[model samples]
Each structure stands twice: as C-alpha cells, then as structure tokens.
Target: MSGTGDDFKWFGEGFDGFPKRLPEDVVEYIIFIINSKLSAIQTRERLQGFQRALATLEKKFLKEYIWQRESIRMDLVCDNRRWFLRGTTNYGDSVADEWLIVYFLRELSQEFPDAWIRIYDTDGEFLLIEAANAIPSWLTPEVAENRVWINNHHLCVIPVSDHDNPKSLAIEEALSIINDVPTKLQHLPKIEQEAFYRLKSFPSAISENQHHATLPIPRKLAYILRSNPSYIAPAVEAFYLRDPISLRLLQPEKSRTQLNFPPESFVSVSVRFTKVLYAQLLGQQWVPPGPYGEALAKLISKESGVPSVSREKAEIGIKVTAGFEMLAQHKLYADKKATREIQLLLEDIEAGDEALPSDDEIARWPKREDNEGWLDIDFVEFEKELAGKGAGSTTRGFGDKNAQDNLRKMVERFNKFIEDEDAGLDGAKGLGLDPMDIDNDSEAPPVGWEDPEDSDDSDDNEDDDEQADKEFEEYERTFEKFLTLSSAEKSALLDDARELAQVEEAEKEEDEEIKKLSEMMEAELFSHGALNLGAKKNSGVKPVMGDGEGRGKAKLEEFLEEVDDNDVEYLDEDYNLAENMLQAFKGQAGMAGPAGNLMSMMGICFPPDADTDEEFKNKNKDPVNNK
Candidate 1:
C-alpha cells in the first residue's frame, strides 16, 4: 500500500474485489498467502490464477452439475470438496500449476453443488480423476462409475460403488487386459509388436471373424501366417488367452487412490509415472530405501542425468523411477537351469548369510518341499507348473491349422532373439585363440603354458596341423548357417543385430535393481532378526562367531551339506558296503602292479596322513560363534 506504482493499485483491487466476488474461497486463499508470508507480487500472481480458474468454472457449473450424467437423480452438493492430492512422483509433489488448479476446482465444487469438475493432465499422462456429489456404479449402474481413466490410449473405469460386488466375466476379462498392459508393453522387445497387436485385436477380430470370415477361419489364419509364420503357438495362445477361466488382456496403469483430509476430496493415481512427488527430507532414508544402501547410492551417483536435471526435475525423476518394481514372480522362472538363476537371485536376498525368501514368495515354487522333504518331482508336470501364469504355453493352439506357419515364425523370431541377444556372436568370438596367428609366424617365439616369453619350442618344428584345422573348421561351422543366408536375409539379420553389448548392460542394470530391492529388505530383516539375536547369541558375553552357535553354526551346516552333495556320489542297496569300499580302493590304485609289489605298496594302505589323529578332532563340530 505504501508503494506509488500502478501495480500497488491492483493490490488494493485484489484485496477488495476477490473477497466480494468469491467471499468464501478468497478469504482462505488470502489468509494462506499471508500466513505463508508471500510477497505482494506473489499474492497478486496467485490471485490472478485463481480468478482465471473461476472464469473457466463460471461457463458450465449449474448446467452440467444439475443432473449427473447417465442419471435422472437430482444432483446435490457434497459437503466437503477440498482436496490436496499428488501422484507418487517427486515423493508425491504436484509438478505444475494445473494440479493446483485441479485442487482449487475441487474446493470450488463443494461451494457450488451444481458444478461438475472435469480435469485431466494436458500432458496426456497422469491420472484423470473426476469428483462430484456422487459417482455411478453397482447400486447405481445406470450412472457412470466414480472414475474414468483414459491412460496411454487405454481406458480403465473403476466403479467404487461396486466395491463389494463381483463383476461379470466380460468386465473382468477387460480388467485383466488393462491390468497387464504395462508388462506386455515392457516385454514388447522380446516379441514382435505385431503379435501383441494381433492378440489385442482379438475381441474385435473374433467377433468380426464370426460375421465376415467364419467359414474360412483356418484358411484366413493360414493366409495371415504366410508373412509371419514364426508367430506359432504363442500367437494362438495369446489370441485364445481370453479364456474367461484364466487370463484376459488389460491395460497397465499405475494408480494411487486415497481419501484426502476433510473427507470430501476424491483422489486417484491412474498411471505409473504420474508426477506426484514424494517429499523426502534431507538425512531421512528415501520413503522406500534398500536395506543395503550401497547399491542405491551407486545408482543415484551413476544417474548421468541427475546433474543435468534441475532440482525440481530431479525430485520428479526420483519419484518416477521409484515405482519401477513391478510384479515379476521369480518362481515363474524356475527350470532345470533355474538353480543358477535362483541361487543368483537369492544371493541378493541375503542378510550376511541367511537366505531371505519370504515365506509367501517361496510357498509353491517347490523348494526342499518344507520337511515334507525327500522330494521327487514329475518333471512333466513340473515343467507345466514352472511356466506359471500367463506363460507362453498357456494355450495349446499349436495344433490349430496355424501351427506350421506359427512354427516357422517362432523359429525365425527365436533366431532373431538369439541374434539380438548376440548369443551366436559370442560363440563365434570364442575362437579368439587363433592357431593361424602362431602358425603363420615361423620365427616367432612359442607361447608356453608356464611362461609367455619362453622360447616356443624353438628347437622343435612340430606344428600340430591337426588342432589348427579343427579350430578353423569349428569356427566356420559355428557361423555357417548365418553366413549362408541370402543377402537380403543377412541384411535383415544385421538390421536386427542391434548390439549384443546391451545384454551385458541390461544384466548389470538388473543386478543393481535387484541389489537395491534386496538392500531395503536387508535393513528391515537386520532390524527384526539381528537386533533380537544379540542376547541369545552372546550368552551375556561376546559373540563366538566361529563356534557352533547362532549364525556360524547355521552357515557351517549349510556349507557342509552343499559340499557333500556336490563332491560325493551315493549308491543303492544293491551293492554291498564292502564291495563299494573295494571299488573305491581299486579306482585309487587299480591293482596296477600286482600282489608282488603289495608289501612295497603298503604306502597305499598306509597313507601319509593316516597317523594324524588330531586332523579331524573338531571335524563337523557345529560352529558355536555368532557370524
């Protein structure tokens, strides 16, 4: 008020007219700014934005809000409409003023019963949540649902009123499709995009097939197969995946739903990467931090874009990436080769030494069978079980007339997958030990097993031509199929090559992510387990980590079991114990010289370490120390 500038003139009008024109809302907003100590210009900026929102609100409040869409019921004002909502991005902070406007309109909706607030992110992302006096669902089936989500060209409507009701098969199938859309999109790189599109087009295509192409169903499928013959059973499997009993396709949408304070505001998160920031203060662990923070710290440090992003943008990115732990069951990956993968996965799930698979996580993956032990699996059934839900083998469409074309397409796709994975190239490069390099150079010093610079058989001129021929032939044969492909095919193959380097790159990234998740679980487990173990482990004294006690004893037992299983073989009752002992003795000495040397060979019966009674005094004794 003291300033003489024209800007000061408007400051008075803002204070005066906003209260009169919007008495209820202006007072609160003005007080909010004053309490927060906003500057004169800052107050003016916010007021202007508020006025503009009002201007937009004036156009359609009473008309649209009179009777709710899809209903003849008279609309009534909901008592509370104020909401402060955000996505799980940047620790749940709203990125732009549009969100604030959304918040403002939500409040305004309460003040005016005849207002229908429609708000969506202009960015074409984030959740589109609609709030009104009432939403239509279940009990109010004639009316629209509480939420209509249009995300990434996908529609998923959540009818809150149907909370306790069971949906019909059609709706559930549609729901499943939307629910899994994100994973399908993520795995698109593994399969051709066309195959996915064809699967998704089924609902419409199947109906069409009934009307237009019913008679030539097999022939039409065959014709479509001519171009993409490799699609095979997987495609048919995906097509029939709408089995009502098991699977359906759904769009994948990341969501957050909450009842805000004041109980009037409607809140929803409709997308995975919505810009709701999570406010993580300095020094506190990020809302969901890994238990072992080393990996997370490295990830944060290695974020090449972190330095380049502004503080505000970095906050959003942090929140966005935080939601990446989508559901992927490791058990679904169980196979004969699963031992290595599972062991590697469990390596991260460790807190010092104990395996940390959650009870629920391992419940049905058929581990040691849980003291219902001595497991024997019918591998035929085990393979089916291992495929898990929504596996490629979900359906047996291979028998359909489309099998031949599908097989070819699958073969081509698999070959391409291997090429894309560079599984073929690595084998080719394994021939780096080129004998030609040594053979072509006559006077070069020979490479020796013990010493590199040792004169390479300089005195002997025996060049093992046999080994060289074998190496060259093997190398050629390795690449023979790919090499013999036509030029066009080769060009296609090269185009698909992309780079094998990415496999290692992705694997390293996956390992880091796994480590990050493990760390979070690790810290949690340590707090729950280790903290409680100190008293039991120490016996009111220092921990004895090396003796048979808490952690050490457990670890020792596990190691011995692993060693025995790996290094020893067992026989059935058919062989007598004496015979087995004799057989082992025979492998050791083979009765090679005869009984004439038996006395001198007493060295075999009396091994060098035989007299040492102390060697195994503590052998297999439980380790009694805290580890």
Candidate 2:
C-alpha cells in the first residue's frame, strides 16, 4: 500500500502528460498505451477496483504507508473529479463538491411537494433554503408526530412561526460567507428580510430595457456599483456619485497610445482634439486617421448620430448635436450645388448648343486644299479621259471628226506609198530586168516604160527610138544571161531575188510615216511638259491640249494650299476637287502625284488652321506687298 512521490506523479501527469512538461509525442504515446490497456468496461472496473483498494489500504497500511498511499489516492480522486467537474460546470453543477446541495434540493422537493427551495452556501457547510411555505401538509403531519427524525444527519431545519412570511436571514448569511461568489456579488452584506426583496428585484435590475428606469445610476456603472456594493453603497447613501456635467466637460488630451474615445459625446471632442493634434504634428488641417481607424471612427460616429433606445437613458444622454449640424450643412450645400448644375445643363440642352464636332467625324468628311496654293484638279474628269483613251478607241481622240478624218487619210496615203514601192519592184522582175539591176539603176524608169508612137515624130523619134533600142538591147543581153541558167536554177534565183525586193520595200515603208508619228508624239509631250517622254510608250493616249493644260495644275495647287490653311466645309467646292483628285489616282499609273498631293491636302485641311495660305504667300511674295 505504501508509495513515494512517484505514485502521485501520474495524477499530475495527465492521461498522456497533457498538463505536465512532457513532449507532445511522449504524451500522445502514453495516451495510446492507456487506451490500448483499457476498454470502456475495463476502465470502469479499474476505477471501482481502485476505490475499493484505497478503502482497504487506508485501514491496513502503516502510518507512513497510509500517508503516502492516502496522498496518491487523494490526488487521483481529485484529478478524476476535476475532469467531470469541467464537463458539468456549464450547467452550474459541481460534480464532486456541490452534490450535497443537489441532494438537499431533491429531498426538499419531495418533502414539500407544493414548493421549491434554492440553497446558497459559502464554504460547503451549513445549507440554507428559501421556501415559499413551511414543509408540505404531508410532511408536517410526519414531523409533528416525530416520525420523520430529519435532524439525524446534517439536516437541521429551523421552522418559521409564520410560514407565509419566511425570512431570508439564514440564506443571506450563507450567501455572505461564500468566498467564490462572483466579484460582482461579493460585497452584499447579510440582512434580515422576511420577503427577500433584493432577490425579487434582481431580474428587473438586470433586464436591459428596465435597467435605466429602475436603477439609480447608469446601467454599466450600476452594475459595477452593485457588485462592489460595500464600496459603492456608502457613496450612494452620501450622494457622492461624480457629477455628469463635470465628466461631460472633461476633455482628455490626445495620447498616441490610446486610439478609442468614448463613443457618445466624446466623438466631437476627439475629432476636435484630433484636428488640433494633426495641425500641431503635420502643420495642417485634420487629415483622417489611418485607413482602418478612420473607417471605424466614421462608422461609430455615424451610428452615434442616430437615436437609439440607449440614448433615452440619462447615463448615455450624450448626443452628437454639432456633428449632425455639420452633416446637415454639407448635405444642403451638396443638394443646392447639384441642382444648379442640373439647371445649367438643361438650359444648354434646350438651347441646342454643343461642343465641337469630334475629330473622327471631321476625318470621315471630304477634303479641300493643300499647302501649295493650287486649285485642286477634278480627278474625275482626268479619270474619264484616261478610261476613254485606255481602251485604244478613236472615239476618245481630242479633235473633231473632220480633223480625225484628215489624219486617217494621211496615214492611208503614207501606207499606199509603201504599197506602190513594193508593186513597182515586183513588176521590174516580171519585165526581165534583174531586180539587182533595178536596184542599181535608181534614176532609170522601171522596166515597163514605152513611149506612145506618133507619125510626124521621125526626128524626135530617131532619138527616142535609138534610146529605146539601146535600152532594149542592153536589157536583152542581161535577160539572155539570166535565161542561160537551168530552169530550176533560174527559178531558185528568181525566188531569192523576189524575197530581197519585198524586204527592201518593207524597210522603205517603215522608214516613212510611223516614225514621223512617233517623233511628233514625243515632241508634243516633251514641249508642254504635259507628259514625260520617258513615260512608258504604253502609257495611255497622249493628253490633248485642254487635258494637258498647266492652268488646271496651277488652280489645283492653289485650292489645296488654301484648304490646308483654312477650316473650310468638307463639301466646299475645293473639297470636292481634292476628293475627286484622290479618287482619280487610286489605280492608274499617272495618278501617284495627284493622289499623294490630295492626301496631304486632306490631312492639312480638316484640322483647325495652324497657318494660313495668305500668310505663307505674303511671306514668299515681293517685299512691297509684305510692307
């Protein structure tokens, strides 16, 4: 039965050394060992077994043995009771220490069936119950006959003479001695009162709705006062509670350590003090506190401004009057200012006034002029001209029908001259003249020449006849030489000669007017600078006089520059010209110049005027005009 301090060690060690300084892992391991060693039934059996063993050991052990074992047993029982006590404390039960109170209450309930009793004790000794009446009629008969002997154990009942007006003197005495009464209830002294008025008043005193009306002081302060009534009662009796006015006027200086101010009246004081502190610290009007603090303070102040039930209480009578006034002022200003702005806006809308047109709208509109002070050319006309000539049709020509007919006739005559030269050379071969002889005899008539015979022309005839005879004799000799060849050889030679003649004819014809027409076109384009000669020959039919005029170019440049310098309407005459010019050069080879210039004009024209054409022109003009 004897044991050393180690026997008591396991009590403090906890189920797994949970309350002692053991490592968590060791504690867990011990818990596992304990659980493995005991099932639910075995755990209950072990408890009963230990209790029985303690009773037996207490009787049989030596004095020292009894002391050590008793210490261990006491520690074990205390630890177990503590575990159960925690489990029951929420329902106001003390499993180990307060069982007697519960037992007494149950017994009294049975003895006095029509009434209930509440017992209060300070040190777990003498018990006192406040009863509505004496013992029940059933119990009074047994007590009068002395058959119940209730005083045998710790049951001592001192009966009241007047059961209808039972006193709480014993209950109060018991309550006064209980050391563990909550601090809020410790100072109430024992008093002799038959009706228990204080207990009856407890419920109403604590009800939040009734606290202000029935309590002499603020609920929070009264609560403090009641708990320490000994200290507060004297002050209440002496009428020494601090003046509310003095507290209201008191303003605590700002302290960095304290952030919260009393919410009701103190908000303004805090705000004003905060402003002063801010001005002092940062040399400026008040800025809000840190983000979180400002948010919380704002919420609290906003709530304080609204009336609540607590506000009706004298103790919490402080109101945010100034804060509300300031808020009202701000709201009034905001509303008035907003109303004025709305009125102004409505007026503007009614008057049909608007800000300037957006840039995108202006961009989408047509253009006018460029920077060079030239009129924008109508590219549509140029495109029409180009389209007409590009098809290579004579209908697109510049001159009237008569002029075109004359030109056509000249081309035909030139072609006929080439055809005649070819025919002459072909006939020379048929006349028995060597085509080579014909080529060499450029001054001679072709081989078919013969003079008409006249009867009186013998003298002139002699000269003519002599020339003819001589030419014929020479031609016959050349023919005989040509005829001396084999038929096949002559035929072959003749074929070769004919081909040479035809080639020569073609060369002569090509040398005639096609070359002339080409040169003329080149000259025209070169002279007027209407078109560049270096332009591809396939460049569509030449620009005529009107189409190629320099006047259009001058006008275009002038219009573009003016449009560029001024804010002219998009559909203005100049803008149409620029737009047409832009369209003209979209796909054609010659359009690049006009297209680029037109786009440049469009960019400069639509925006607000940065510089004007007159200014630019005057700057470039003669000094007399500049003056």
Candidate 3:
C-alpha cells in the first residue's frame, strides 16, 4: 500500500495506505448490490420483480459477503424522460463509493427535476424512513407499496392506492394525476421538512468536496466529519478495539497530527451528539480511523465550550469517552426492537399517558365503584314531560281515561285501513282520520262485527276457507298484542322494522349487481373466445374459386354463426384441427400439406399452366434463388 497522488487522495493522506481494490468475490458482490440500488432508481418497469430480485440477493449473498472495498461504479442509460440502470459496473469507479452513489444520484435529481428516482436496498427506502412519522395519514403499507418516490432529491409521496395495477402503470397514472400540481419542500409538514433538510446536509461533504477537520487526517474523512462531526465518534469507537501494535498506524510521532483535548468536555458533547447516527453507521463506506480518536477529543472540547486539556492523561480519557458514547448511540439505533418500543413510548407520552398500560390495569380501569351513582340518578324527565304534553294528558285521571278510549278507537281504525289497503285507499292516510273525534265513527265496522256468534256467514266462510280464516285469526291476535304496547315502544318497534327492511333491500340489490357483473364478464369472455375460434376456423378455410370478396364475407359470417352455436363445445374438436392445419400450412396458404404431397407424389400436380398462376409466380419470385 503506497501513498496515492494528491489528485487521487479522495480519502486524504491517512487513507492512502488503505486497500483500494477489494477481493474479486467482494467486488462482484458490491457491484451486484450497487446495481440493485441503481435498478430501483432507474425505472418502475417490473418493480415487483425488482423487489423479489433484491430479496433473493439479500437472502443469498448479503450475510455472507463483507463490503471491504472502498470503490464503486454504476452503468446508467437514459431513455425519453427516464433513466435506466444496467446490471453492469463499467461506468468508471469512485472512492468513498457509497457516498459517491448518493452524490451522483443527487446530481441526476438536479438534472431531471421532474423525473422521480427511487433508491432503496434491503435496508429499506433511504428518504421515506427518515420522515416516516410525517407521511400522509392515508399512506398505509398497501397504498404506499409502489407510490414512494423522489423528485429533485426531495421526498414526494404520490397519494394513490393502486396496488392492484402493475407498478409501471400505477406510477404513470399517479404522476399524470398530479402532473400539474407543484410539490415543494416547504409544503411538507414542519417536522418532515426539517428531516429532509437534515438528510440533505449530511451528504454535503461529498457534494461540496471540502475538508473541515482540524487534524491531519484523510481529506475524505475530513470532509465527512466537517459536514457531520458526530460521525467521527463511531470511527473513534472502532479505533479502541485495535491492538497496541496497530496504534502505530496513527503515526503518533508526526508533528502535523498532534492534538490536545480535555476529558470533562466529553459529557456535553455526548449529550448533543445525534442519536440516529445514520451517517456514521450506514452512510460511510467504512468506519474511518487513524487520527479520528484524537480529533474527536478535540471536537468534544470545542463543542462543549471547554478549553482543551494539555495533559496527556486527561486527553486519553476524553478520546476514550468520545468513542464509547458514539458507539452507544450507533448501537441504540441499530437495535430492531428498540425503535418499535421507543415509538410506542413516544405515542404514550404524547397521549398524556407516561407509560403503556398493562392488560390487567386496562381491565381494572372501568371497575371503579364510584360509577354506580350514575345508575341511581333518574334520566326520564324528557319522557315525563312528553307524557304531560298534547291533548291526552292535560290532567292525570281524566287524561288516562281518554287515552284508553282513544287507543281502542285507533286500533279499530288501523284494522279497517289494513282491510282497505287492497283498494285505492292509502293505508297511512286512512290511519290519520283523528281517533279523538268520537263523532267520526262511520268508518268503523258495524256492531257485532267482532262477535263470530252474531254473524250467520262466519261459520259458512270458515268452512269454505279454513286456511284464510286461520291466517285472519292469527293476524288479529298479533295486532292485539301490538296494540298493548305503549306509544314509545310501538314507535321504536316500527322504526326498527323499517330499518331492517331497508337493510335487507340494500343487500338484495348489491347481491343482484354482483351477479349481473359476473354474468356480463362471463358473456364477454365467451364472446371473445367465439370470435377467436371463428378467426382460427376461417384461417383454415380456403376461398372458393370465382366467389370473389363478397363470397369471403358470407363464408366468414357462416363460420362465426357456427362458432356462436357450438360455443365452448367447439374447443374439444374443431379447435385442435384448425390450430394444427393453420400451423402446418402457415405462409404457403395454397399448399394444403398432405393433399399437396399426395398430388405431388402421384405426379399429377402439374406445373403452372394458367396465366394467373404464372403471374403470381413471377410476382412472388425470390431474388436470391431467381425462381
């Protein structure tokens, strides 16, 4: 490992000796990984297949392979308004490879501001997860399946639920729907915009290409730490694991790399450090080293507003503390279960509940004995007021007697309406004849109508129509029971019956609609099959001589009719023969396979004798064969 030239020192002088070329297997693996990420950014075509491909790669390779290489390449192509990424790695290579990919993609985003580019690996979507809490309320996993996209390096959600359609079609339709609507970063929720900007600032080291670290470290790492200084914490943490002999790589004797930092400042710096640590743990190609530990000690002193410690003993402790805190933060975000638990805790806290309730606590919550007082209080004041209102309840005793008489008259009037419902008379209007008007008794049945013994025709009618008599008697008994209920109870029962009838009618209509749709689809399928069958059958039939174009039309109609009559039954027999014959005599048309062969074998197949045949032969002559 020799020092790289100044022009090639992307990772700075400290990383010059670091390996540039990875092992062949590792190179191949990283290339595949890079290509997979690029493929997702390129196009939405076969997106479901793309997801499956990524899953297969992760299952088969990711766990086994180590990303030791510090270089990567991309093969990109552009179609009309879209970029396509090929699964090859020939488009030159760059150092700080992973960041370089992000840099290049950001540049592409700037170039094609309208075009959406999605970049994701097995880790999940890069931009969406950062602003997960701020996504739209309607964005469920199913709705957001293929709608997550990036336009101009800003996260934009296409709010449509079209998971049933192909990914390509869904994307196209979604974009078209919102084509005229401008989506700006400022339009996003405050928290979401903040997240986007934070992520945007993380890649500034690569984008700006400037070094900011005060120590004599690699230029590449200097730029990265300059953009997000907390990244140095993870590097310092990794440096601690090295053996004493490996410390020689730091070149401590070099005057240019020397730095002094204090131990007490580590506390404040650790408190201010990023908890997510995405840049250090997931962004960078590798955990940087060399002078980063000492550099981080200096960072701690500066960030905490404490003066640097000159004592070597205090500086060592400060560096160690810095590394340990960085490692802790990195591990915290990396834990799978911690994120979910933290989210639940945050939700609880937001809802004014500091802790998640246990199952037993939840069960006991509603068992408070104080709630029993609610049952002791009377809430029937409205019902009492209602009973006092109207003409039936002016005074207690007199009103009660009038109510009983009115009820008897109302039942009689309702029964008469039911009998006249078969005629042009309206049941509702007939029942509205005012039961309180005692003088309007003309509509009521004659005296002794209720007594079977008083009617001479009752016995004769019962014997003549036994079943009708039983049904009428049953109806009368049910009506009597219905009349016994109070006004409120009767009203409630009628309302429930009306609602139930409405629900049943709606369900019946829906079922009928579904049945009709199914039948229509089946008919369409059958019709399409019939048309295809007619075409195939027509293809096998030769035109009759001298019948001209009109004859061909008649023959096609006849064949279509035949297909319609036979329907699916034709699939069993004529379909096979038609398919085979068409295939056997394809292109030749006039040459009827076995018949032509038999005629040729018998020596009866004459050469072209007619003028039309010779003219056809001359027109169809092969220039290559001159025949």
Candidate 4:
C-alpha cells in the first residue's frame, strides 16, 4: 500500500477498498474534497493536475475521485438461487449515497423478477428505520441488524446467527420465516411503496455534471438547495409525497374567516403553473430532460399567459401544490379518525352496557288494541335515565300504546275536561285576575237571616258547598299575602316568574317548529305519490277530439234547449239585417260617381245617381278642368 500508483494495491478496481491506513482527519479531508470539488466533471478536469500530484503522494485520493462519478457503489454476488446485491457508502459517507442505492435496488428488482434479489447496505438497514412501526413484530433490532434486505421489492428481515457463515444461510433463514408467515414483513408498506413509485424517476446519476433544472419549490428552499445539491433528490421525493407535516413546514396559516381577506386575495400574484398543480402531478403528460422541465413550465406559462418562469412564480406553484397535498392529507387523517371512532363504537356495543334494555324486555311489552292513540312514552323520565348514563352512550328502547277505541275516548275526555273549569279558575290569581269577581257580584245575605234546610238529607250538600267556600277563602288569602309583599320584593318575584314564562314560551316555540318540520317532511314523503304514473285518475282539461269529445256535449245541448223560440227568431232577424247593411256598404265602395264618393266619405252607402255621373264626366272633359 505505497503512495506510488502501481504499488497502491489496497485501492482496488471500482474503489472497493478504502484508505484504512490513513489518519482519520486526512481521510475526512479527502472525503470533503471528493464530495465538494470532484462532484462535477468540469471541476474534476480542472483539478486533474492537483489530483495526480495528490494521488502520487497518497493514492487513496484517486480512488475517492473516481467513486464520485458512479451512481451506485455496490458489489453483486450469487450463490445458488439467491442473488446478493451489497452496497456501501461512497467516500466513507453512507448518508450521501443511501437513497440512490435504495432506488437502484428497486429498479434492479423490477428488472430481475424471478431472482431472489437480497439487497442491503453494509452501513445500515434499508428502509427499516422509516418503516419500523409498519414492519412485523418479529423484526426486532437484534434480529434485523446486518440481516435486513429488500427482497423481491419487499422488506425481508433475514436473521443470521453468525456473520462468519456463508450468505446462503441467511437466504435459507428468510425462506423459513416466509414459510411460517408468508405475508409478514415481506411486503413494502403502502405509504412507503407509494413514495418509491413517485420518486422512481429521479436522476440516478449522482454528479454535478448533469444539470438538474429547478423544481417548483419555495425560493428559500431553492436557495438552500443551491448550496447543498445532495438534498435535492430527497426534497423532490418529499414534495411528491406531500405529507401534511412536510408541506406545512414553511407555510403560513390562512385567515380564511377574516372579513378583510377576500377570496380573490388567494389569486396568484405571479405566473404559477396552477393548472397542472395536482396531488401527485396527476394531469401532466410532461417528461424530463432536453426540455428538462420544459413541458410543465411551458404548460403553466401558457395557462397564465406569462412567457417566462421566475423563482417567485415557481414558489407560488409550489405553495398551491402544497395546498392540494395538505387537503389530501387532511382527508386521509379524517377518514382514519372516523374509522377509529367507529371501531371504538362497535367495541362498546359488543361489550354491552347495563343501562340499555335487553331484547327480551322489549319483546315482553304489551301491544296496542287500536291505533291512533298517544304512545305511553314518558319522555321526561327517559331523558333523566339518559342523563344518568352520560352523553357518551346511547341505546334502543320500546313504547306501548294500549288505549282502545282512542278517538271516541279522546272526544269524551275533551268534553269532561271542558266541563270541569276548576283547573282554569285556580290559575286566575297567577294571571292577575280575581276569581271572586268572575264568580259573583250579588250583595251578601243579612247576618241574622239563615235559610232553613228543606230536609236532613240536604245537610251533606250544604257541607260540601261550605268546604268549597273554605278552599276559595284559603286561595284568596294566599293571593292577598302575595300582594302585601314590598314593591321591590314583588318586582323581583315578577321578574323571576317572567323568566320562567319566557323559558316555557321558548320551549313551546321550539316544540312547534320541530313539529311543523316533521309534518312538512311527512308531506314531502307523500307528495311524490302525486307525480307517479296514473296517480291522477282524470285530467280536468276536456279532450279536443276523440271518444271523450262528447263527454261535455250534453251540457252544451241542454243549455241550447233551454233558450226561448222567440229569442232564436229575433237573433235570426238581426243577423239578416246586419248582412243587408254589410252588402250595401260593399256596393257603395264599387260606385264611381261624385254622389257615390260623397256617400262613401260620409260612411253611408247609396245607389249611384245617373245625372251625377254624366255631370261629373262633362265637367272633367273640359281642357282647363283636365289640366
């Protein structure tokens, strides 16, 4: 491992071996030079003389320089049916080239379908960190350490008991695990798979020689990426995925409900490729290179009528695209939340709550003998029970309607209710109306004049009247006590009463509205029947002609028959007179004499006079008159 090019045996072909003998700081400095300076072909060419001198001094520098141009740094080996594609980081830094290797392995799996392609990085497990939660339970860190690989486009956790053993044992272990649980850990997670599919077309070559056109990204991000182009690949993939958390990183919260923030304010201030802004760029037919980003850029430019693309326009498009992505992510989160809530609800139902009535209890309830009766449902009691159970629970229950011949019984009850007016009288004091004023206005009897009972049997009737009078006196006393309260106390009590009344009034109004809504809904449900075919038995409009033409002819004939004969004769005479007058008027129009013209001017028709016609012709024949 001498400094001379020919003697540097440790620097193998394809830069497989590293400069292990070199000091750590020197190796790090060489890595930095390779990543920063040798990334582009032009830079490499310009530094060729310096690299040659450095290579002659320390040959490991040349190996690092050559490694920069290659896209994927990997070694391939095969044992029986298992194909091992081993990858390692270029220039001792795995972070710089891990994604490129992962993407290349995916492309390789698609290319070699039948082969058991087991791909892994020597430095770290592939995709295991990203999909740790999604992977199977058995894929523990210990089991997966140095054993995890992507097989057949799926994450396969193959445990190896000893690293010293051949690679075939690891393949056998994978096969055994697959046999036990075929679907476990051997499939890429849905979200991760989608991400790979979207980012599959990223430029595979890791070099600054190939210029990558700017993506529709934020200006700040663009600026950041200009310095660190290595971040571009991951950034593009993240943009495609449009995860809400990622999208919202630099976006400001929108004040959508603000009065001053009009809807038109959201209109792009510059040319943005908004028409093609979709979740996953679904509408674009554009591809990359020569016109690298030309198709999308041109389409967006044409849509906005702005001929050129600028960083501001690109930033706008990126912002809107992030909005679309955010909307999708929100919907996904909502759907997941709804699914979880429904699952919990189902579990609660299965667990069963004691407050709910059982099926047997509902079945044992009595049936109604007749319909059209008020259901025996104590809603107040039901509400109390529901409140006791808490808002988080609900249940099904039953009702009984056992009133027989309800309509007739309801009429009788109404009559009895109206006859017993004592209930109305009891509320008179509360209504600020004196009950005694409504009962009677006659003067009281003299103190010594007592009416003698007609018989002993009448004493009970008197006693009952006395009891009624005593009750009325007690009610009057209560009313007087209420009036004796101070004005302030009375006002306070009145206000309290008014509030209660207002509450009751509001409740009544609400109940009425609900009842009216229910009735309208019921009407709407039945209204559709009117629109059904043949629902209307007869159309009111009479037929113009057909078998139904004579349907109303009888009424016309009867009306004609009811007319007098004299009236018909008079109608005929009037018609003849009118015909004669019309003929005279027409004849007058045909007359050609002066008398006829005079009659026509007067609107009176006359027979042409022979003398007048000769007189007119003679007068017109004179030369002076003709001129």
What TM-score should be assigned to candidate 2? 0.15
Best by TM-score: 3
Backbone clash total, candidate 2 = 18
The estimated TM-scores of all candidates read 0.14, 0.15, 0.22, 0.20
Which prediction has the highest lDDT against the true structure? 3
**Worst-scoring 10-residue span by lDDT in model 4:** 25-34
Clashes within 3 Å, all models in order: 41, 18, 1, 1
lDDT of candidates 1 onward, in order: 0.30, 0.31, 0.40, 0.38
Q: Which tens-of-lDDT digit does each residue in 1-627 have in candidate 2?
A: 011222233655653442222211110000000223455555445444434544553344322110100022211222422110001111111111233223333333343332212322221111222221223322221121111111111232333334534322332332232223312221111211211322332222221111011111222222222222222212221112223322222222322232111333221111111111111222211222232233334444554333222312212122222111122123232343322443344355447663322335433534321121111222333333434322245333433222233344344434544555434744421223434655564587668644555546666778999999999999988866874577579769977998999999999898887898767754543343433223332233211111223443465556557664355444243344433332334333443343344345655322211134454345566777655
Candidate that beats the other on lDDT, 1 or 2, i.e. the better one? 2
- Cα distance off (Å), candidate 3, residue 432: 49
In model 2, the runs with Cα more than 4 Å from the true position are 1-254, 261-314, 317-627
The regions of model 4 sitting more than 4 angstroms off are: 1-96, 145-147, 156-172, 175-185, 188-627
lDDT of 2: 0.31
